[model samples]
Target: MAVPRVLILRAPGTNCDEETAFAFEAAGAVTERVHVNRLIENPKLAEDFQVLCLPGGFSYGDDIAAGRILASQLDRHLGDMVRQFCDQDRLVLGICNGFQVLMRLGVLTSGVRETQPATLTWNDHGRFEDRWVHLAVDKTKTPCVFLKGIDKMYLPIAHAEGKFVTADAEALKAFGDAGRLALRYTAADAGQASDEVLPFPSNPNGSEANVAGICDATGRLFGLMPHPERHIDPTHHPQWTRRAQQPQWGEGFAIFKNAVDYFGE
Candidate 1:
């Protein structure tokens, strides 16, 4: 079987595309860093990539609002292409600003309204918060191909607006009940379970219900505020002192590994 080809998007001011690509490549996939402008210029380029990723960064300088302008540009220029990808059941992910872009695209849920059931903006503790967070796995949802069988893992998060808010509380509950909530923030001690309130760094931005990551109804589309690409190695951890007994398994790579394996399977 051949390795999967993943496309990591690169937009102006976005700085993490390289590391994101490295993570996916390390996960046994052939990765490419494609510039957003070139993608727009040649829309067919998207067809070559099986998985699409919008890596974390300050795109468009986060002007007006995070991912607003870039989202608008994509909506105006590449809307059909994006819709086509989604219709084909292809995997789409937005991490941090990428999450902001997906929310703005109005694809988080089935409908489009100012207050949709899918995505929301959340304020951090006054300023940008950057650190590691622990998350639990939701096993019920099949559409969540990336997190299949993952009970929990540690991923890094860096953002000011990382909270996930939604208008459809009931729908949100349904996702949780269905096990679509892929990850949640937790404490360093690993004392908190999935049912309880997610502690700081665990639910980094204090997201509603302590959600660190989520997927669409199909589970193919995923978005998270945490930076999984940052934790692809144990060395990325700040507390290397604790590394002796428990070597960090580099959980972030699982996201990419799962994607590749899903397509290969």
Candidate 2:
């Protein structure tokens, strides 16, 4: 079978493209790091790949907002290509800043409107957070293919404006109802069972419902504030030396592998 192709969409300030692409390549997919401007010049270039990724970084320097400039560029020009890519059952993954761009572009919801139902905002603590975190995947709820066979993950979250807030209480519930609320922060030491508020290090950004990531209704499109690429290698973990032996691979690689497997099938 031919290896799946992944397009690692990049723009000014997008520094993680190389590592993110490396993860996908190691997972048996070929990757091309395409700049947003190139895509803007020829939107049809997106048709060449089965997966599209928006990796983490402060796009356009985050002068106005983290992903605002890049998001607008997509909304104005390549919107159709993006919509078509997801409509074809292809995949899209956004991490950290990429997640923020997806939210602003309204592509996460598969459409655009004057007002968004949810958004990524400033952390409750009003400071940047950079550390490892525990994540839980709601298998019953989310159709996010990237999380298949994964129950929990220890990944890093580095960002200042990573909080997720819904427009209203009902809206938040609807996400939960539709299984759109897929990834969440769990108590570091235990599985997700309690309804207790996960403060500080646990929740990181104090996102409502301890939300850490989410998928579209189809689950084919997903975005999260955590840096999965950073964890694709075992040594990337802070406690690698403490473990008895090196693990075969880091959990983050599973995400890209799933995407490759989906297309391979």
lDDT of 2 by residue, 1-265 (tens): 6578899999999999999989999999999999999999998899989888999999999879889999898989998988887789789999999999999977775432346889999999999999999988887777888989889999998999999988888777777777777889988787662235588888999898888888888889999999999999899999999999898899799998898999767
Clashing residue pairs found in predicted model 2: none
Per residue, candidate 1 scores C-alpha lDDT tens digits across 1-265 of 6677888888898988999899888889898898889989999999987888999999999988888888998899989878876778578888889989988887765633345676656565757887777776656443588887676777777888777766676866766766556667666666333645665655667677777777777778888888888888877767756755656457777888888887867
How high is the CA lDDT of each candidate model? 0.77, 0.87
Best by TM-score: 2
The prediction achieving the highest lDDT against the true structure is: 2
Question: Which window of 10 residues has the lowest lDDT sum in candidate 1?
Answer: 111-120
TM-score of 1: 0.90
